[model samples]
Target: MTLPTLTIGNKNYSSWSMRPWLALRWADIRFEEQIIPLGPRGLGPNPDILAVSPTGTVPVLELASGERIWDSVSICEWAHEQAPEAKLWPEVSIARALARSAVAEMHSGFSALRKALPMNIKRVKRDHSISAETQVQIDRFDALLQSLITRFGGGQASWIFGHPTIVDAFFAPIATRVRTYNVKVSAPVEAWCQTVFSDSAFRAWEAAARKETWIITETDEA
Candidate 1:
């Protein structure tokens, strides 16, 4: 059988691509990957990407049946659908609702933090300064993480909702950003970041990212 294809950009710089990629990997779904190099500084309008992606972006999932799904979160949702047994979201109704909320917030909000600290998995900038708006978002994220951990963490599980889920996959990229920029975070948040870093799937992706020679100069400067 032909496997589904995930079209992605540079692993070193594409956080959006990383999200659904992690979801699929962690869910143990098999898929092929096609990498289309992004334009300089990661600016796009690339005909190659545009040909396959409706949004002219990376991280599009093309199924064997010829269905195409775009956007990181959308692709993640598709992964969940493909493997419901993976339990990508929390099984508990309330917990699942909260998990979806967290993923959606990460999807739509956090613009300031994203703008200030773009993900560059191969690079680390210790003691990097962030803008006031970025700090506000970081503080908000910290509070959200703390709240989730306290309510659902059950002491032993490091991931939000007490186990790895779509929530973990969605936030994996942000965790990389925190480490990349050496952003100060609370102990619980830091522990969660460690969990993300230590994940085998994430490690595989990071290893590939480090090996990639493509450089988006704009994110490299960040």
Candidate 2:
């Protein structure tokens, strides 16, 4: 059977797109990919894309059944349904809820961190000190991770559930952000980021992101 196709923005910088893309890939789900560059004056919308994603957003998921999933979280759910054996969520009930909460928090919170550490996979490394607002968000994120790891007995696992779950996908961008901005963080969080960056799947995504030519003006931090 033909698998669904995932449309995403530049791999290097599109945090939203990376969430589902990573989850799907890490799960070993077979699918095709379409890359959209988001920077200013990049490739305009394609006629084919305009038909699938009305908002013209990258990271739209097109199911084999011809259904369109526009948002990243929704795509995560869709993947879960398609590959139930993948165990994309936590197996335990409480861990599942906590995982969902973490994912949702990442979905809605951290505006400052998002603004300060816009993903640019190829950009030269440098520390942009966290702003007061960004620091607050960072602290909250740190507390959340610390608590989860403490509860779950962390080691090489991707997230609180002790495996790669939707929560990991949600925060993968934040992992990139923390490293990109060189934000001061506890050892555990830093270790988590290290694990994420070193993952082969993430490295593949980064490679593709660096190859993208699109340059959305809005995301240019330099």
On TM-score, the candidate that comes out on top is 1
Q: All candidates' TM-scores?
A: 0.95, 0.89
TM-score, cand. 2: 0.89
- What are the root-mean-square deviations of the candidates from the true structure over C-alphas? 1.5, 2.6
Tens-place lDDT digits, model 2, residues 1-222: 977899987787889999999889767888999876565544776655576797777789888888889998999987888777778887889988988898888888888778877877766556566678878998999999878877873544445556677887888888887766677788877777877888888889888777777766556554
- In order, the Cα lDDT scores of the candidates are 0.88, 0.79
- Give a tens-digit lDDT track for model 1, residues 8-51: 99888888899999999878899999999875634557889989
Which residue ranges in model 1 land beyond 4 Å of their true spot? 41-44
- Which is the leading candidate under lDDT? 1
Residue 1, candidate 2: how far off, in angstroms?
Answer: 3.1
